[model samples]
Target: MTAAPVKNLTLADFLHLPYVEESPAWEYVDGVLQQKPMPKTRHSMLQKRLLTAVDAATEDYTALPELRCTFGGRSTVPDVAVVVWERIPVNDLGEPEDHFTLAPDWTIEILSPDQKATRVIDNILHCLKHGCRLGWMLDPDDYAVFVFQSQRETEVFRGDRLLPMLEGIDLSLTAEQIFSWLQVKRR
Candidate 1:
């Protein structure tokens, strides 16, 4: 269910509001607080696997799990956020900032069973509009993945079809392998 806006708020005002960082995860979009559905085992499995794969394969780009990104007049926490080494925000001591001020280079979202695909897609599109190079919406229920490239059409990848990685990432993964991570091993 969509969370209705309690009141119209500017980006600055919304940032000051408490509990956005606390679980259950809340997203601020269209001046409303939208609560993210709880993640199931399948959702957590895929998110972890993808982040690990992308992080290991690329040296210049790093993928972080559940990073809250604030940009494009909205604040959201992508399941995974991949940003280039230089683009990562750092403070006076060069440590990464608590919050990202710009859009991620790539954003990944895993679909919860009760969530609407359009809502996730809209978030991906919003990221693309503000300099996100790529986005992926993983739907475990449908066993399909939607790949979004900046300025291009959305493409669905399934089964053994290779999911595209970032320009220099060099990691080749398939939808089958991604979903397989959810399967528990037999003892």
Candidate 2:
């Protein structure tokens, strides 16, 4: 027997569904769904390193990995999500949900070569507007990072400077160090 055709679901409908085990490659934007292509090796490595460093630095807090969150009907899975320890919600059993409903305190996105800068910037801006305290857009090719804070201005860092948001956290990696990690060695 032929199966019934599935209807295209809106972002609202998507959220009502059960939680997914694996993070999907789709993002919801303005009531429409968009697919993100698989990240390249450099993109993947940078994302992993950033997540590791951020988690290590904020060990006192409750940070999560690729957690699904919604902001104004848009569902985005940020590369790394830092949730302030105190602000974390407790469940009936006195445990926090694996996924968060609100925007994270910090969101970081590593731009893939094929991804559009405007789109990535929009995501950062969206996070800021929705109460995210900090956001970072790392450009692998240019070795630059664009930092954004809610209710504040945006800043760009290049070369050998430490990021401002990471000041209290004491992260000392420079742009050169970040890019160098992406390089492959010849045997």
Candidate 3:
């Protein structure tokens, strides 16, 4: 027995349809629709690491994982988002919904081989413009992290030193330490 074929649909059509368990992953860019790739192992590892670090630093605050958020009409699934606990809205059942309409306080994106740098940068900028306090783009190949803060210059970290962002939260891991974790063999 064979399964039924799925139809190729536009972003507009995809949005109008009810959310399903097996909805095709989609991203909208300037009114154009693009499919996102499934993350690879390296990408997954880095995302988990970053999430863990941020979660530890922001334990007192509410942090969401892989939540679909809409900003500037561009719905995206950021790897991780940190929201102040007080800002989260509770439904009638006193539970948070799966989707969030508000911008996150912080957004992080891990680069995949198939993803374009320019597109990722655009997303980061979009987040900044939408009141996101901070954004980070992690490049696996270069083992570098780019930090963005609204109305401030972007900072690039390539060595072993803590990347700044967290306030009142103490974290000591540096950029070099993060990249070193990607290595299978250390010199």
Candidate 4:
């Protein structure tokens, strides 16, 4: 006996599927289901530090980690998703909507050891093609970041060079500064 071939899930079905916040996020890309790689210590540290840094640097935008964004017929969970305050949808009572049906203003992904860069880059490009302002792919091990912008070539940043930031955001983060988050200070 052989196992049955798994059927691809539709976007609606994928969205309707039960999800637990603590579990790895599920993504639907081109009618395929994928599980985002679990964040390791370095990845988690960068995600948290980047989110805090971005949020602290600007009041016009907010950053969230592992937030699922659906748009352009695909759903992706970026390591850090930044949305402009004005673009965030609110409900009748003025609370933020639970479901984000649009691409984030800035999509950030930190590369994991077991994750494939091409796939991550594909997601970023997908977001860019669908109105995302900027994308950053951070490689912790290399202490580098790849920046993506619509209608432009991808740029790599390292050392003291500042990474590209979304418009309206006042952050001036560098690759070195971002990678430095992994170092634990011993008192």
Top of the candidates by TM-score: 1
Model 4 lDDT on a 0 to 1 scale: 0.86
Q: What overall lDDT, based on C-alpha atoms, would model 3 receive against the true structure?
A: 0.72
lDDT of 2 at 64: 66
Candidate numbers sorted by lDDT from highest down: 1, 4, 2, 3
State the C-alpha lDDT per candidate.
0.87, 0.73, 0.72, 0.86
Worst 10 residues of 4 by lDDT: 1-10
Sequence-dependent TM-score of model 1: 0.95
Off by over 4 Å in 2: 1-9, 16-24, 166-168, 185-187
Deviation of model 2 at 70, angstroms: 1.0
Colliding pairs, model 4: none
lDDT of 3 by residue, 1-187 (tens): 1112235654456466554213334555566555555677888777777777767876655556677677677776677787776667778998876567777888888888888778778877898888888888888898889999999899888887678765754567677877776766658
Q: Quick one: best lDDT, which candidate? A: 1
Q: What's each prediction's TM-score?
A: 0.95, 0.82, 0.82, 0.93
Query: What stretches of model 4 exceed 4 Å from their correct place?
Result: 1-8, 19-22
Which regions in candidate 3 have their CA more than 4 angstroms from the true location?
A: 1-14, 18-24, 184-187
Q: How do these models rank on TM-score, best leading?
A: 1, 4, 3, 2
Kindly report the root-mean-square deviation of model 3 from the true structure over all alpha carbons.
5.1
Candidate 1 Cα misplacement greater than 4 A, ranges:
none
Model 2: lDDT equals: 0.73
